[model samples]
Target: MKILIDINHPAHVHYFRHFARIMQSYGHETLFVSRNKEMAQRLLALYNIPYMDRGKGRDSRLGKLMYLIYADYQLFKISAAFNPDLYLNFLHPYPSQVAALLGKPSLVFSDTEHASLHHKLTVPFATKVYTPACYKLDLGQKHVRFNSFMELSYLHPNYFTPNPAILDVLGVQPGEKYAIVRFVSWAAAHDFDHTGMSAANKLKAVQTLAGHAKVFITSEGALPTALEKYRISIPVDKMHDAIYYSSLVFGESATMASEAAVLGTPAIFIDNDGRGYTDEEERKYGLVFNFTESNADQLRAIDKAEAILSDKDAPQKYKHLRETLLADCIDTTQFMVNQALQFSTAHPDPVMPVNS
Candidate 1:
């Protein structure tokens, strides 16, 4: 089978790379399509896969609209030529739109709940929509709920062994403790201004956490001068290693927060947003804390830190829970690939998203 995977962000590359590899391992020809954004190219370059860059335009609304329009046209031209058997990627409208046009069975994977705009653009066209059960989207019949997150499948212990080789790559010793902090540019078109931490707040958080442990900051936007003082020793290229070995993670980026949790690190999501997927993941698996941005005061964080450290059993407990949760869940990549195969076999021509 010929397969194509689309990546809109750097993290998406991490989440989907394993799946693409599995497909290739099974003798399927795989292609990766990516937007020229952030470190997306940097990360995807690690894999030996064919890929194309869908260059982005200005960041403004009109600019993004123009980018999407131009990119979608380009995508259509590419899809017509590649003629993939399966089109898999994040819940992006453009790729799905092209897949619909080319009659290729498409699968969209997303954990985002507040997807009103996503639904308006992509749902009607996708062949299947897979999400964590806790996701808030109303897909009616097309929704396929899973108990696990995309993070757990790829980052879980079964599939992920802490490649200490990664530590060598980052030049970090085995036992050094560090905290990873992430900041999102709420300026993105889809960001919705929901990022609870401002540049000033991030500086303060990094400074306070740095008092206890070495800190590494990863942000979608440039860091402030005060925060940039603690430059990450590990190149942005090897961030996952730093993340995997981190003692703790404090971030507003849901994806990284969940990634840390799956790595069995103490992850704190400091955002005003409450009880979202990360929050639920923390409750279901004991590796994380969802601190409301309002209550993420320094004092509160100190207490949470103390609790995580004081409980000698906490990490072990979360690891146990992660293992158990994973045992009950399907191999997400295999599941996705199998779904694509089945869809293509059942419907030679692309059908509208199931239940649409």
Candidate 2:
């Protein structure tokens, strides 16, 4: 079967990279289409996955709304030629719309509940919706729940193993204490009104964490000159390795927090918006801590980080928690590939997500 996969974000590339390869090895052809986001294209190159460039993206709400038609047209033109049996993406509206016009099924993988706008536009046309059980919003019968976070699609033990060599690239030795803190640009539609740490709080958080460990900063927007010196200097694809060996991660990016948790690193998530997967990671597994935009809660995150750093055993404890979390989740990469094939192939395979 021919499958068309849309990669809009860097994380989406990771979400489908492994599944695409496995599909190809089993005699399926996968065509990759991507938006011209900085890191998405870079990481796709790093993964050695070739794709068609759909063009640049917009950060403003008005620009995004205006550009949707052009994006849909571009995708429609491409899908017209590719004639894919199915369309796939990490919860985007474009592919699903194009798939509907072509009378094809679109499988959307999603976990972010705050993205109400995207879901509202895409779900009606989507053939299937795959989301984590922790997701709070119900999308009715078309929704399928898996007891795993979308990050696990690629980061699961079945597909990934951390390489300490990443530390060498960062000019850091193994066992050295360090942390990864992500700052988002708050420019996307869903990001509207949702805020992360303020400039003052960001500076404070950095100063506080610096006293506990070497801090590496990753941000979607520009940093002040004072913080620019701490911007991570390494190949973007090597980020997971950096996260894996880090002592801890605290950030505005819920995806990063969840990634850190599954990698056995203690994580503290802070933002006005909370994600269900990270909530599960915090309450069920004790691998992550969540905080809101309030000053007191944000301060609590700093305190938690200091406490984790002070306790040498914190790493081992989180690692054990990761194991238990893994035991309860499915191998999402395999699950995605099989789900695609089951819909279009010979075996008439009838399967549901393990957790369901």
Candidate 3:
């Protein structure tokens, strides 16, 4: 079987990198095409995943609209040449539409319920939309629910193991305490009103956490001069390497927060929109704590962070919880590979490609 995958984000690379490898190991061919979403290509190179670059995406609404047309034109030409059996992406708009046009099946994976516009634009064109079982919103008849988080596709122990050498990259000595704090720019369409870790709160958290452990701040936007010294300077692909070694993750980005939890590190997620998987990670596994962006709520989160760091047994406790959590989840990369192969064979496209 031949598969064409569209990677639009750095996380998308992680989600499908292992799946792509498994398919190739089985004697199948794969074509990876990616849009420039900050560090996506660099990470792909770090993982040795070969792919075609679609170009860097735009910032303004009008620029994005223009880029869409250019991207689809390029995709059409690429698909005609590759003549793939199936198209796959993390709910990308272009591949789903192009696959439908080519009379081939496209599989889209999604987890964000709040990306309503994205869903409406892409879901109808997709042959099937697979989502996590904990997905809060119903995406109608085409939505097929699975029992695992996208993070499991890569972060599951089956695919990833922490390298202590990465600690040397971060300049951390043995037994030294550290915390990773992430801040998103709130630039995505769904993040219109959703905000987390206000500037005041960010400085406060930094000040409070600095007293306990080395604090490293990863931000998509500008950092205040007061916090300039704390800015993290590590390779893009090494973000998880740092997260795995951290004692705690306090941030607005749920993805990194969840990434921390799955790695046995406790995460305190502060956002107005609490995610389903994060909620379960907090409620069932007790590995994550969620708080809204409010004076009272975020303060409690700070207190919680301090408490977790102060507790000598928190690492062992979270490690046990991670094991319990892992035992319940499936190997997501294997599942994805099976789904792409199954969909291709079960519903073969009769229309031959122009290149064919």
Candidate 4:
């Protein structure tokens, strides 16, 4: 089978990389098409996955709409030539629309329930929509719920093992305490009106956490001059390794928080909107703390971080919680591969060509 996978974010690369390789081992052909969003292409290269670049995305509403047309054209041209039997992506619109036009099955995966705009544009054209069982929004008959987090697609023990050499790279001793803090650009359509940590709170959180542990910040946006010195300088692909060894993770990114939580690190997620997966991580596993962008909640989140840092047993406690989480969840990469192969076998018809 020939599959066309679209990547819109760096995380999407991780989401499908393992599945793509395993599919190839089973004698299937896979093609990746990606936008030049932050680290998406760079990561694809790092993983030795060849992909066609669709071009950089736009942040403004008008620009985004225009880019949508441009990206669709680019992908449509590529898909027409490749004649893929299937399409796959992480809640992206371009592949879904193109798949509909070309008459192919597109399997779109999503975990962010609040991405209402993305859902409207992509779900209708998608042949199947997959989401974590914790996802709050319902996407009608096409929706399929999985008993696992997307992070597990790559971070699960079956696929990943943390490297301790990241400690030397971070200039830390084996048992030294440190924190990973993330800040996002907030330019996505879903992040439209939502906010994360305020400038003041960003400083407060870092400063408070620094007192208990060394702090390294990673931001998609520019950091304030005062916080710039703390920006992390590790290779992009090594981030999960860094997170695995960190004492804590405090961030505006639900993905990073989820990554940390699954890696057995305590995470504090600060955003105006909470994700269902993060909510479950907090409620079911006690591995993450979720806070709103409200001033009170932000402060409370910082306090919680400090409290967690003070507890010397935090690592052992969170690791135990992570084992519980692992036991309850499926290996997402395996699940996705099984689903794709099953769907392809059941639908043996060739994909119809795109109309001129």
Candidate 5:
């Protein structure tokens, strides 16, 4: 079977990288088409996954609409030639749109419950939409629930192993304690009204957390001069290893927070609207702490981070919690591959591209 996967974000690359390899090992063909957003294209190159560039996305409303049309046309052309048996993505609209035009099924995976605009634009065109069982909103009949977090697709023990060499690279000793702090650019469609930690809070969080443990900031946007020294410079692919070895993670990114939580590192996620998966991680496994972007809540989040850092047994405790989480969840990459193969087998006939 031939499969075409669209990548819109760096995280989407990780979500499907393992799946693509596993599919190929089974003697199937896989094609990746990606937007040159942030590190998306670079990561594809790093992983040696050949992909077609779908152009860098735009930020303005009118520019976004234009890019949407441009991306659809580009993908349509690529799909026409590739003639893939199925389409897959992380809730990206272009694949669903192009797949519909090409008369193929598109399977979309999403764990973000608050991406209403994205859902409105993409869900109607998707063949089936998959989300974690803990997702808050229901997508009616097309909705398929899974028993795992999206981060597990790559971070699961079966797929990922932490490299202690990262410690030497970071100039930290074997037993040193450090924290990974993340900040998002707030540029996505779903992030329209959402806000994360304020500038003052960002400074405060870094300063306070630094006192407790060595701080490393990873921001999508430019960091303030005062905080520049704390910025982390590591290979993009080794980020998971950094998180795995961190004593705590304090950030405005839900994805990073979930990544840290699943890796047995406690994460404090701050945002006005929280993700369903992060909420579940906080409530069920106690590996993540979710906080609103309010002033009071941000302070509380920092306090929680410091408290966790102060505890000598926090790492062991979170490690135990992570084991329970792993035991409860499925290997997401295998599950995704299984779903695609089963879906393709059920609809054995190849979808012929319609004449434009």
Candidate 6:
């Protein structure tokens, strides 16, 4: 089988790299085409991921519109040449649409059910739209629902193991307490801007938390200079390591916040709209806590963190929850790959190219 995957973000790279490897192992060929977003270059170097760069334009509205147009054109050209047996991607509008137009099977993996303006136009065209049942968006078909989240495939305990070596690389020493803080711009088509935490709120939370643990901050935009006074450390790109060993995680980024919770690192997520798979599923499964921006309820979260930190039995509790969650969820990557391959074989398009 031949597969073409279009990745739009650094998180997508991490999430899909394992899937690409899995496909290759099954005697399939894979090609990745993606936006040259923030972590793209480094990810390519770190993972040896081969990708075609669809460079970003400026950050203005006009620039974004033009970039999308260019990206579509590039995807069309790439798909024409590669003629992939199957098109598998996260939630790409133009790329997936092009694949469908080519009469090829397009499997769109998404956790968001809330239809973005873009999805309103493109989702109906996809052959399969896989989503977590907690997704609030209505895709108007049974194929749109998937019981599993993308995180389960990779972040689940079955596949994920914390790298102590990565801790060493980050210069983290024993007994040095630290908390991970993540902030995202949420510039996607979703109305996620409501989850924005002000600089004052972050400093206030960090000040309170830092009194108990070292604070490490990571954000899509730059951190406030005032945060530097508190000795907050934001590593250039060692986010996974920070989350893996953190005393706790607090964030507005739905994805990373859930990653922390599922990894059994207790997390507090404050979002205007809690719409991600991890946020909805983790809380539903009682593995994590979520707060709306208006509620801003940190009291219970703070108390929970304090208890978890000082208690001798906290790690054991986390371990138990992690194990329980893992047992209940399906491996998302294996399920997605198997389904994609099956779809490809059953509906091969002669006009489409398969890498091998």
Q: Give one digit per residue, the lDDT tens place, for model 2 in 156-231.
A: 8878888889888887877789988888888777889876777887888888899988999999999988899899
Taking all chains together, each candidate's TM-score versus the true structure is 0.87, 0.96, 0.93, 0.96, 0.96, 0.87
- Per-residue CA lDDT of candidate 6, range 148-265, in tens? 6676657765467776665565456765667777777766656434546666677777777777777777767777887755443444345666677777787776777667766777
What is the clash tally of candidate 4? 0
**What is the per-residue lDDT of model 1 for residues 1-356, given as tens digits with 9 covering 90 to 100?**
78778888777887778777766665667788889888788777765555798885456767767877887888887787888877888876888888888887788888876555666688888888998777865687777886667786577654677657766655557765567777777655566656566556666667677666677777666777777766666655556667777777777777888887766677777655543568676767666777765544634754676555455566566667666556655556655655665654533433212210
**Candidate 3 lDDT over residue span 203-266, tens digit each:** 9999999988999999888998999899999888778878888899998988998899889899
As for candidate 4, its clashing pairs are: none
Clashing pairs in 3: none
Clashes of 2: 0
Superposed on all Cα atoms, the candidates' RMSDs to the truth, in angstroms, are: 4.4, 1.8, 4.9, 4.8, 4.8, 4.7
Which predicted model would earn the best lDDT? 4
lDDT of 1 at 231: 62
How does model 5 fare in lDDT? 0.91
Residue pairs with backbone overlap in model 5: none
lDDT of 5 by residue, 1-356 (tens): 89999999999999999999988877788999999999999999999999999999998778888899999999999988999989999986889988888788999999988888789889999999999999999998999998999999999988999999999889888878999999999989888877788899999999999898899999999999999999999999899999999999898899999999899999999988899999999999999999999999999999999999999999899999999999999888877887888766643433322111
Worst 10 residues of 3 by lDDT: 347-356
Question: Any idea what lDDT model 3 has?
Answer: 0.85
State which candidate, 1 or 2, has the greater lDDT.
Answer: 2
Global lDDT of each candidate: 0.70, 0.87, 0.85, 0.92, 0.91, 0.68
> What is the model-wide C-alpha lDDT for candidate 2?
0.87
Ranked by lDDT from best down, the candidates are 4, 5, 2, 3, 1, 6
